[model samples]
Target chain A: MAQATLDIPANKIWGGGTSPFGASYGKLMMWFFLLSDAFSFSSLLVALGYARHVHADTWPLVENVFFHFPLTHAHLPLLYVGLMTFILIISSVTMVLAVDAGHTNNKKGVIFWLGLTVVGGLVFLGSQAWEWYTFIVGGEGVVKSIIVDGEVQKVLVQGANLQNNEYGHTLFANFFFFITGFHGFHVFSGVVINAIVLYQATQGVFERRGHYEMVEKAGLYWHFVDLVWVFVFTFFYLL
Target chain B: MNHVEDQSLHYSRPHSRTPEESKAVRKKILVVTGLLSLITVVEILIGVYFSKTHVGEGTWTLIKWFYIILTLVKAGYIVLVFMHLGDENKSLRTTVLLPMVLVIYLIFIALFEGEVLIQYVQEFMK
Candidate 1:
């Protein structure tokens, strides 16, 4: 029985040698890193969930907080965020195209799609910066109590911080800043990595190696970022 | 000798699918993108509808559940198609997905314990 078991191929027993799962070393490593990152993000979101649960009665409504529209005084609840989500999703589509092109060794196709992806990322980052600024600047006519000549007077309170916010609870802004800021940082680094990979592709580095696995790895990271955003959008905005 | 080595490096054949196969792949990608976009649009519509309407407490809770389910569906589809996890071997898929169970458990416990703490605080105040 032991001899018969030994006769079976190692690949048959353990997927494959060294890789053990048919994935290359780098791809497997990327998956592990993503899994760890996922844990961190999930924990943060869960913490946010706890906060929301505790403050269920007084938690600021997402629609009321994010109501401003671009270049208009009209309140467009979730319109801008919807646009941002669409842009990110479209960028993810372009990234898939780039990876598909890589599979076929189409350098020009990869370059074009990758360029579009980078542009999409930059657009998203710009939109996020504007959003953060808007959040900090806050809305007009929001009032908080102020001590004036030993008398408490109601005055407009703007912006947000750890201690004070125009929103209902300071925890809301805290989580928003922390979670979205962390995600934005990921997008920034992803764009940088994409640019580097694009440069390498142009130089025929992957072609020289007879594979575009680098592009595929980068694509995995991009998709993971988009995946995380889906959850964030649901938890923070939709729910 | 250097020229010979360079030629060898340049001439190695990468995997090349035929035009028909490539077209199929493109179609699959489009389908996945369409599905994801559709789910997102539905989610947005539901959110807008519920916000505009004064639904019962039970109905509101149901809608929130819908949002969470839809989000998970979208996330699952992306991981399966765009990340190519669906095409990967069983062992590889398991390696990537199995650990996620722990995270889910963590979330459940955190929420439960957090609720308990909230109740405790409320009682203490009374």
Candidate 2:
């Protein structure tokens, strides 16, 4: 029988009482969670891409689909989505600031930045809700063919749902709802978590604990949300 | 609890950094944000321009590739900086990144299989 080594220092390789990955257990767990989440998102996106490829000729142009801007009837392709992307990215920046503040044990700074992050998340969520509403209640209209009583009839399709959409393929709207809706849910949860963390920061909980690791962990989640949006913007909107 | 007594706790450690360090960190954060925004703007511009003008099929495909590359760049930067992955140990970084190879493989198989199915169906119909 092999004898176990007994003289290894606690901080050395294969030693006990050390963070093997050089990060706290909670943070590493968060990374693993994010990695798994990334797979889920990517699988959805790849499926979307496959659907688009299959329906390439008939698929609605993304720019034409998302052309309408708020308060202006003018067609501004990608303007609103772009603004939403910017808002989310800026929120990620604020989240970083909040994490940095946590590192320095600045209670006021953590509260302020985390508050901004929550607000940014809320704004992005609100924008997504509006976008979904617009999509469901579509603008203009596309003529769709239907068979009625053994005769072909021409009918206009407006708005979107599981069954019908103004866009060319129903799969387009399905993927839109499924992918973005899932991401929007993530943003929603992130905002709620930020709110709780902000409240705790206001109470100086992390200060008392002598670490702001909670903020860092939350920041990782927020940034991952933003990162996923980047791919969504490209695959769903830009391409 | 008194301030002095609070300081005696094991959890108490001075976390305050020099103003210069804080400023530098803030500047780095701003720079990354600027880069992300710039990439978004470029993506939008290319999309709009291509939508307006009739481009060759090859050119359009190239533009799509460009968009994917740019998006990846932005994602990498956000993960590295905002997630603080860049500051982590090499083994930790690898632990996070190594699994991504599987994701890429998944995407490739999905796209390839989808294309083959589409082609088969088209041939059958013809």
Best by TM-score: 2
Off by over 4 Å in 2: A1-12, A147-154, B1-14
List-wise, what DockQ does each model earn?
Answer: 0.45, 0.48
Off by over 4 Å in 1: A1-10, A15-18, A145-155, B1-13
Local lDDT at A145 for model 1? 81
lDDT of 1 at A186: 92
Q: Which predicted model would earn the best DockQ?
A: 2
RMSD for all candidates, in order, please. 4.0, 4.0
Report the lDDT tens digits of candidate 1 across residue range B1-126: 453233222322346898899899999999989998898888877776678247887898899888898888999889999999998888889988999999788878878988898999899999
lDDT of 1 by residue, A68-112 (tens): 767988877787887788889999999999998987889999999
Q: Name the 10 consecutive residues with the lowest summed lDDT in model 1 chain B.
A: B3-12
User: TM-score (chain B) for model 1?
Assistant: 0.83
